[model samples]
Target: MKNLIAATYAPMHTDGSLNTDKIKDYSQFLTKNNVSGVFMNGSTGDFTSLTIDERKAITLAWSENKSKDLYLIDHVGDPSLKVAKELAQYASDKVDAIAAIAPFYFRLNSIDKLIDYCKEIAICAPNLPFYYYHIPVLSGAQLNMASFLEQAKDNIPNLAGIKFTNNDLIDYGHCKSKANSKYNILFGYDELFINSLPLGATGWVGSTYNHLAPLYYKIKELFENGNMEAAADLQSKAIKFVELLNSKGGFNGVGKGFMRVLGVDCGPSRFPHTTLSDSDYIEIKEALDGIGLKSWFSK
Candidate 1:
């Protein structure tokens, strides 16, 4: 739960089947860019569209290419608790850590229910650190995260921290102060990385980090050097990167294609997420250049 962790894309074949062969190169690419960790089988990965077996395959591929410098965090969340537990068990031995988003379909309205759900999955991977992926937008469980940490601390033994994707800075502050700043609250909102620094965010997990690691590292450096204005400007540029890609169909699909521009060749995204043609990528890159983001692209 330190430094930038890319919520990785699940590489696919043209037929929309899992192309795990690309993962070795994907891992190498992230490491080359100095992205310290990978959060696979999560939203950026289109986990909801993939089968349990497919999700497991993604984890295995990453595990095989695992490096000391690049740690792996497999997101084992599923609407089905059984499936989540199964994925957790499968990932337990393979990854450095594991995370689970709340059951998105049914939705856990109460904190206790969420803790119970996490508790079950945590026990499956008792040895590995557990992270609760608190992305309320997609999960639909907008319960207070601070309250969750207060309650879950005692019940869940392996509870390391939360991937706080929500934008509620007040609640994020409360979560950071909880247990005397004990839990590793890895901020998940890419656009708000600078904002989180004031609240003491040492770790981050985001899709944008996949493309702009150096930019973010620079942002952090500027902020630490007491250059708030420059940090804000760079953060604005990073946000523009997201907005630019999102303008082309949707960011999820378009962003995956941008990976190819970085030389990973993750192939195309699945249905509902618009897959861009080669010409479309050219247009997208041109658009990025127009916004002055070409220099920030992950190396």
Candidate 2:
């Protein structure tokens, strides 16, 4: 659960069918690159683009490839509480942990409501740990997680921590400092992993971890060695890498395609997610090299 945890993309064949065949290789690829965990079926995995059966197949695939080195945290969030519960129950025995975001359709209006939503889902997997995926920009449930911890701490018995995916560093710091530092506040702003260090964050979950793990580890190493200038420089380059492709189109799809440059093709993105041509990637690679990030690509 600590260190870099990749929010993996769902591998698909050209026909847009689930290609669970590559799950093991994906796991090994991540492990070889120094990634410690895989956070599956999250936003990066294009969960919203998948059907219930396909999602189930993904869970089964990852579960079968589960290893001691790669901790799996399945994001079981769905707009329907019933569906989220089903997903939670389905992933209960399969993953190392389970997480759910607030129901986005009618989004939970209060911290209490969110707690209630999480409690039901957590109870479904009573034996396993539960994480609340707090990404307000997407879910529209922008409550203070510090307050969430105050109210939810005792209520949800298995509330392991949060997949904190926002830039409210103030509230994030509060969550980190809450209740004698009881919860595992996994920082989610990939571009701001440098900022999290000052706040005492050790774990992070992000999609870019899939591409730039070794680079991040080097950043961590440099920072811990008192080379703030070098660490911040690399961190800024990483941020630039995201901005570069994000400028071309949307980042999610472009970034997913960049996985192939590192020798693992995650395949074409689904509808609304643009898949780049090999030439597009080649051009992007040239752009990456221009910024002195050629060596950072995951291998």
lDDT of 1 by residue, 1-299 (tens): 58999999999999989999998888888899999999999999999989888998999999999999898999999999999999999998899999999998899999999999999999999999999999999999999999999898889998999999999999999999994757899999999999999998999999989999999999999999999999999999888888888998899999999988888889889988989999989988898888778898897
lDDT of each: 0.92, 0.91
TM-score of each: 0.98, 0.98
lDDT by residue for model 2 (1-299), tens: 68999999999888888889988889999999889999999999999999988998999999999888999999999999999999999998899999999998897889989999999999999988899999999999989999999999889999899999999999999998894657888999999999999888899999999988988999999989999999999999999998998987788999888888888878989989889899999999999999999898788
Which regions of candidate 2 fall more than 4 Å away from where they truly are? 179-181
RMSD for each model, in Å, please? 0.9, 0.9
Off by over 4 Å in 1: 179-181
Candidate with best lDDT: 1
Model 2 scores worst on lDDT over the 10 consecutive residues at 176-185
